[model samples]
Target: MIKNFLNKLPKKQVKSAESRDGGSLALSSNASTTSRINSASGARSGNVNSLENNSTQNSGVNHGNKLHDPLRSKANGSSPPVPYEALPGFRDVPSAEKQNLFIRKLSMCCVVFDFTDPTKHLNEKDVKRQTLVELVDYVSSANGKFSDVVLQEIVRVVSTNLFRTLSTQPRENKVLEGLDVEEEEPLMDPAWPHLQIVYEFLLRFVTSPETDAKLAKRYVDHSFILRLLDLFDSEDPREREYLKTVLHRIYGKFMVHRPFIRKTINNIFYRFIFETEKHNGIAELLEILGSIINGFALPLKEEHKLFLVRALIPLHKPKCIPMYHQQLTYSITQFVEKDCKLADTVIRGLLKYWPITNSSKEVMFLGELEEVLEATQPPEFQRCMVPLFRQIGRCMSSSHFQVG
Candidate 1:
């Protein structure tokens, strides 16, 4: 009766039933299928049964209830399966189907979850987050050899939503003349973590050796780089840090775009200096520009000289001059080193912005002056000596200092 019942069971359920029964029965019509299933299940169940019996017997003797060799079964033949890369041929030309699937998966990862209704979609949100993390991990490990299609897809998704919560443009006045109302709420998204992941992925993308040229030519445009600069004013320190790294990476990898990056930073500095726009990443941006200036060739371009005069020189006028002092000094020194003739120009610029009331700042200015004087050639120094000593004489006679 039991044999008849087992034989009558559907093929799908038969294997499950056989597993439950320790695979003791031979019920299938195909002899090889029945033999293979029986043998495999018997071995699996035998290991499990031995483990259970050993634990039962050793419960009192072992004191910790420890059984022998938990990995013994896996060692024999039941090892955990290996995970395959979802985007194969990522280093070369991926197949059309794989590319399409990768695009679909990437698009799905961009889905924003409504945190206000987390109760309804908690499970779905978790699954999506995990998928995004895994996908980002895979791409980052590729070392920047992504196909052109993949690079475009990544740039499309990242640019649109990188600053989803924050506006790149200045905030507008929402209140009307006489109406009393509550303040407007900030537009924040719950998926900032995912956004951060994508930013990190982009950092890796730009820094990847194979992808640098591709990114510069195909994906990284002037508008996209400008949008990144606009994000420099983000209130969130974390977002600003990520932006700093990403911008630096872009500057490093895309040599062709370095001029534009400097120009954009110069415009931002113009606003911060002249218009007094509050930008938190000025120090960070200067840090990046310092490296770019270091790499400039001799006989600096007129634009490069103007940047040092207009952008970097005025940077010292801000209250937070100390914050960017090191990077600012390095950039100034780079210019002077590149062309000793610029030494007089830099010193004159420094004297123009030299602090008035703050004695400590005056000392800092003097230190920067000494560096320029040290780097200045004798002939160049002689050219500006009269005006340079005139400024020093004024410093000595100023009311803030008392001569010994």
Candidate 2:
């Protein structure tokens, strides 16, 4: 039947037909539309949907080869710099077919060395670490040819297996037990080079023109970038510094590509500042935010004052803000003079006193009246406060501030 005929056909012939027929090898058409199809066996469908939604589909336009190639060779004897698109050994074999074959081989490697086998990989420690790193590397290089569906499935399998392996490893008892892992030279250290390779692949892929916006969105999705950032501290200083460089390039390239990475960074900043559990972590977080605001403001297009105001509004509400504000108020009142800057900071930080809408003006006016009365000024001041009070009463009666 059809299966027998397909099986009998040459591999190249089958692939050509599959690509032409919009079968397993085909990318979704650039029509900004999607149709559901039940996947064949283990083939993933998610990348098809992702590509259809985020790529040429959403934009409803196809990118032609007409776009100028920045990597193109110059006519004159100009400087010859390496192109990002041209990886080592990528020049001789430029066809998409070759890329696909590379991806398939890497994917098979992950399947062979399963990390989730606790009994085999448990407190075996360094051996397990080295093996898992190799698996991650193999799967991570699957950037160029495999559809998002294929890449996602591979990552899912790798991450789940690695997580299980790491979880089963006996917890280190002494503070310094696992800290000296880098001092010993590796029996192979094959993992290090592979890790760098995979990391580079991911970095390039996410920022590549070939990747659609929808797929690019997944790069920073669910705190993935932050999680990657957290991984740096666990490495040796040199390796950690190298990873930071890679992360810097990734984040920078993302912001340059999409521009919305600033907002993403801002969101991260808010979490670091207002939501993080560790109090000492605040200074480092603030420095990072300050660096972002100062260095990348134009690219970020952030509304600094307005963004702070917006963040403050939620924090002002009593039920919403933490009880720490109340305790801070007490601490400030005990330590600082009545009219001191610390007292002002505490009060301003604690209250969302500014009315969000005109409807709250009456309440604001009442609070103002109490404040003026408490200040207990001279007769002339009292006379000025009285007229202000009358003005507030008139505005309230007339409803001039409200919109219909």
Candidate 3:
């Protein structure tokens, strides 16, 4: 019966179900350090040299009429306020002029517009959307490599658009027990039509072989990462899905950012578990973490173990566990698979957070517990067997027949 019920549980759309990894994470290097890298790899690409001195300092942009923000360039105070005509296509410009055109278009895109109210900035908004599509294609097929200035402009444009204050989400009506989003209608970001293009451009920019990580790191620095992390709380799932992929790629490529990224994610999880207990991207984040854990090199680090004990296990305490438990359990199983010695610690942690009042969560917990026990070693089992069965005894007598 437990097997039947567990088998019937809905599976989430986990993109990183397996480890699809590239090179080991590489830490970002400073100027002299980058010079050494340049020399070491015979200076990997022109981009490394192009972006040595770039810095990632972004003062927050001023918001205007939800659809758009104040433009960063001289265009902001222009008498008319909006640009007279759309920037010419990148392809239309001479090769020498394309770079400047790219920067100008980026500056134009920096100003976000209120798409919900199409009555405002109708022409300007259409221009930016077309420009974003052009930028995506341009980044996709740009020849040699991005220059330092170009790299900085790309990050600046991406930051300007993607990292706005998300709309106020509806309050979660905490269910004593259940598995569902609190909101009946998912709150779609009104600007997503434009925001989606920006996200795509960023994704392509990161994944582009031309956008060398060595130089890109200067702009895609820790500050950029924090801003990206904040967007995980976005009410829009589509937005979160794009964020998940971009972050995973960033983590994989920029080795230096891994510890910072993981630690920050832990902090987010801690806040979600302890303070807020609400986040749309928890499952998506766990999906990325699951991939990351799967690719863990042997002799798993103590940091990994601590993450399991601190963030991953206590995650069970949230009423929203069902929202993210599939990814959570997958992540936990990765830890155990990597180091069976952690099985005892995991079993004990599961028992510690075992649902006493929420039978639905209890069922979810039991389902995950079964997965953990399947991989538990005999010696580890002996270590926690007594308390484990003791909890099982309580669960057997659970007033909820299904949980029993």
Candidate 4:
């Protein structure tokens, strides 16, 4: 099974530039060694038979001239086609030799994004983009059961400065270069598609069943979680959509990190509210927190209750209430559902932050007040009824309603 799976790997077709000493390294067969790697990968997933049966012809390295070296052309000031070495057909090359080449090529592909200098590293954006696409494709084709070494390398690259730089906020200058200067500069800029691929790679890493345990134990840490939360403020709606799923997956898989994730989000919310920081993905983050709130254990802790009172409740006071209204309402309702005694507190908090100038918001408060009233038990409802009706009376008498 190991030999067969290795033979199915796409061999590197690119020829190395000739050395000054003029000696080419000979490719050798190491069937015995690769069989060991295949065995280990198979043992890790316990599904080698499935991998062999699903192998297809389209899996080979036939990405055209995309594999050419970018630096060579940059130095010469003229585009030249660099010939790539074609892999021998499955029948022509021994399985062992193909396996050895496959392992070596995979290693190089994983290390391509490890450059320390941003200028030099991003210059080869095309190569890095293609390599990432190929890696994603290979892993997907294998049903997300790649070798641990390959997975580790991919995690390392995504965690590097290069990937972070590409995934950060895109500059207009970079976008214009992709548009006017060089058509080949698509991935060189912080284009949404390129960032989407990086995010998709991360989504795959966290969600893949084969890598779930390792990802939870290793990649999902405090610093990584904070980075993800920071990315939640991205202005690109598409990027934020992808980030929403990635973050939810992190929250779902790393159960131990749940408290910390919630705390970090609380800090972000506090900044957005009290400190007046702008965050584009606030609605998305609130949506995730709503789900987390739904799962809170009964007789909730003081900190959790405080999060609802301080963070979740005041969140409604933001000018962009409609953006997160649904999520915030759900979270607030979940708290009331957890304990009826808290209903009065929630009602009082809503009245405290009730909008004064916005008639539409006054109307929204009525709707929310109606929901909170429905959730309150008879005693709690009676207890809070006076203040609620007083606030209602104020809304009816407001000058904005008189005009309407």
Error of model 2, residue 205, in angstroms: 2.5
For candidate 3, which ten residues in a row score worst on lDDT? 51-60
Put the candidates in TM-score order, highest first.
Answer: 3, 1, 4, 2
Candidate 1, superposed: residue stretches over 4 Å from native? 1-98, 113-124, 143-145, 165-192, 209-216, 397-404
Model 3, 248-334: lDDT tens digits are: 778866777888888999999999999989887898788878877877777877788899899999998888777788889998998
Q: Which pairs clash inside model 4?
A: 13-85
Q: Write the per-residue lDDT of candidate 2 for residues 1-404, one digit (tens) a residue.
A: 22221232222211111111111111111111111111211122123212112112110111223112211111221111211121223234566554554444333223222222222322222222233333333333445444676546444433322221111222221213211212332121112322332343344444344555455445345455555444432322223333433444444444432234335544653564466422212222222333333332222223643444444223333221231233222222322222222223323432334333444443433443344344433543443544455445555675434411
Compose the digit string of candidate 4's lDDT tens values, residues 1-404. Answer: 33443454333311211222211211122123224223323222343223322121111121223323211011222222233222333335575564344344343333222222223333334443454455444444444354555555555545542234234544222213112222222222223323444565676666566665544455557876777777676555555666766676666666667678778999999998887635667877877666666566666778878988889888876676665676678778878987788998999999899877677667677788778878899988788789888887777677775313
Q: Between prediction 2 and prediction 4, which has the larger lDDT?
A: 4
TM-score of 2: 0.32
User: In candidate 2, residue 214 scores what lDDT?
Assistant: 54
Model 1 Cα lDDT, one tens digit per residue, 177-277: 22122354333333344455566567656655657574446778887788788877764444565676567656655656666777788999999888863
Candidate 2 residue runs with Cα over 4 Å from true position: 1-96, 109-193, 218-220, 232-235, 253-290, 296-404
Clashing pairs in 2: 32-57
Ten contiguous residues minimizing lDDT sum, candidate 1? 57-66
User: What does the lDDT come to for candidate 4?
Assistant: 0.55
Q: What is the lDDT of residue 404 in candidate 1?
A: 6
Supply candidate 1's per-residue lDDT for 106. 66
